[model samples]
Every structure is written in C-alpha cells, then in structure tokens.
Target: MSKKLTKNKKKYRDKISHNKKYSLEKAIEIIKKTNFVKFNASVDIAICLGIDPRLPDQMVRGSIKLPNGIGKNTIVLALVDQERELEAKESGADYVGLDYIEKIKSGWTDNIDVIVATPSVMNKLSILGKILGPKGLMPNPKMDTVSTDIKKSIEEFKYGKVFFKSDRYGIIHSSVGRISFSNQHLLENIKEFMRKIIQSKPSSSKGSYIKNVCLSSTMGSGSVSLDIKNFD
Candidate 1:
C-alpha cells in the first residue's frame, strides 16, 4: 500500500510538471506568432504603463466586467456610515461596517482582498497612512473606494474594479482574467485595458509614457511580451 501511494504521488507530480512545461512552450509560441499590430491573443495579459504622479487625480478608477472574471475569490469589506450600513449588507459584501477601519488597524482584517467605504470613513482612516497604504489596500478617492452609493459600489467591485499601482520595479500588476478564460475573450479584455492606460497618459509627460508590457499566467514561468507602441 505504501509503495502504491508513493507511485500515485509521483504520477500526480509528473503530470503537473508536464502540464506546466507545455503551457510555457505554448505561451512562447503564441507570443512569437502574434505580431505587434495583430498580436491579439485569446489570453489576457498584464499591462504596465507610465504615468505622472503629479496629476494623481487623472488616474482612471472604475468597474469593468472582465469577459473572463478574475479566478481568485475576493473578500470585500464595506465601510459606511450608520445609514448605509444595511444597504452594504444587502449588496453581498463579505463584511460590512463603519468601524472596519479600526478593525483593520487592530490586525483583524485578514483574508480581505477589496475594501469599499464612504468618504467620511476614508478621511478618518487616512491617519493609518502607513499601514494599509503599503499593502495597496488603501481606500483612496481615485479608486472609488470612498462613496455613498453602496449598491453601485458593491456591484462594480464584484465584477472587476481592480485597483492598480506601480511596484518598486515600475510595474503595475493586477489580475486581468483567469487561466480558464478563452484566449479571444482574454485578448479583448487586455486590449480594452491597454486602451484605457494609453488614453490616461498625462499631458505633462512629454516622452513615451508606455514603456513596455508583458503577460504571464500566475505562478507560471516566463512572460510573453506585448508591444504598446500602437496599442489602440
């Protein structure tokens, strides 16, 4: 029985490894075959674009229905005043309350992915600038996290109102779609995102703002490159 179990485990591991290798090779082939102009793939790719931080207000923030939804399950925390609290509850959020900011500060906000709050709560929580700020979970005005429209906000977030920002490498990372998504649908979503990024370029930035872009499966090896020169 022990020998059989060991053999089964080895088989499972070999199957996973083989699948990963094939996926990587296929991704490279897709990248090479697709030209910059007609290089649209059925898979959605992560896009990075340059922006001027000075004009922070111009950043785009809103919900979009990704043709293929992001695969990972998200836990949403709705922070609202007393009146809108009930509305938030009805909107299908995992957790809802005005005091959520305090809970977060107290280190109770584990396994939470998204946060929506009213403007008042945002002002109060701004004092926690250093804590949530580093995690990219900061409820900001630009991302529509602070809003009184509880229903609209909740619905939007459920779809895909992804909050994106640059990392230490100047790369803005956000999940565009799931691995199960069809290549065509993913490509369309990627194109739409790229179009928005290009349109959002600040007028103050003189040189080319969109430096480069690449896409990869999460936790998978090697990224396929995409050209942003004429990403319309």
Candidate 2:
C-alpha cells in the first residue's frame, strides 16, 4: 500500500480500536464521523453469518420498508401493460414500458436503482436475465418487486424499500440510512433490519448464525464492530 493510504487508515484506526465492540448508538455515531466525502454518504451495515450458503435451505433473502427512507435517490424501472403504465409513472417509476424491454434487449440498462414488473410481463423477461440477474435488478415476488399492483410496488420502492440477500460468504450487506438522518432514526432502522435478518435465519445451519456485525460509511472511514445482542 502507498504511504498516504496507510496514513489514512492509521487515522481511522486511531479513533477506533479493532477489538472494541460498540453499542448500536455509539456505532451509528462513529459511522457519521467516517464520512470524508463532500456528498451526504450512505450509512451501511454488514452482517457476517455462520452458515453453509451452498445449501439449498440456507439462503437468506428479504425486503423491508425502512422506518426512515434511505436518503439517496431511488430510481425504479417498471415493466407492465398499457393500463398500468400510467399508474407506474404516476407512482414515480423512472422508466416504464415495452420499449424498456427493447432497450434492455439491446443492452441499455443504466442509471436504474430498482426494477418492478407485473406478473403478466415476467414471462417476457427470460432474455434479459443475464443482463439484470447479476445486478440484482431482476424482479422477484418474494422481494415484493414483482406484483400486479404496480402503483404500490413503485411507491414502496420510491420511498426506500430495501431488498437484501446474503452472498456466498454468508454476509448480508445493505445500506440502512443516510448520514443526514437523525441518530434515533438510524438506530430504529438498524434494529428493524436486524430483526428481519434474524427472522430469516435458515434452520438447517444449527450453529451461531450471526457471527459478526459492523457499521461503516460508504467512503470508508470508521468501521466499527457492533455487538449483535445490542440490536437484538
């Protein structure tokens, strides 16, 4: 590593020790201090779990309507029929259409935050899976991003409904709130998110599921260990 990068890492390490685990409030407070960027950065939580992710029954995936919406702009792409197109746009879908399907077919998915589609249109999306699947943009009914109610889905997503999934490493990483939000709001969101995660635990694992939790900022300043039971 370069001398400057090492110096910056030392700066953060000075503020926080590696072994100390902080409470929920203290962790959120430290998270704000780590934002060195000019823009209002996102506050994220990374939960490391103990599970065999390759097992069929050990997958973790869910969505939540955060108590306080994520402060960043959420762009939604809605795929629906003629009747629902107007409602989708009215509900704040950034892009809506059959034309979107064509655009996506031609490899044009850009600047999109979330994708919402009706059941009728899901059948037509087989071709775009390779494009959208890797990005987690493919709509799923379990995530509440796929439905017949275009308006509700669009509204929820527009208001910061977050979808999360654990990776092969048995870790679920997602943004909980923005730095601009009140500390109490951030705490509440974190608690709710943790509750959802704990509820979604796979029964087959049988060991300690939540192995570790940490809070940090998008720009990477303060990464603080958090006690799992504090949020529980």
For every candidate in turn, the CA RMSD to the true structure comes to 8.2, 2.3
Whole-model lDDT per candidate = 0.61, 0.87
Q: After superposing candidate 2, which stretches have Cα over 4 Å from the reference? A: 1-9
Cα-based lDDT at residue 106, candidate 1:
80
Cα lDDT of model 1 by residue, 56-152, tens digit: 5434344444555565566888887788888888887889886766777787768877787877776677766787776767776667777768788
Q: Using alpha carbons, what is the TM-score of model 1?
A: 0.72
Candidate 2 lDDT by residue in tens digits, 1-232: 4566557756776889779989998888777766666668889999998888888799899899999888877999998888788888889999998789889888888899899999998999988999999988998898998888889989988988899998999999999998889999999899999999999998888889899999988766767999887955
Which 10-residue window of candidate 1 scores lowest in summed lDDT?
33-42
* Clashing pairs for predicted structure model 1, backbone only: 42-183, 42-184, 43-183
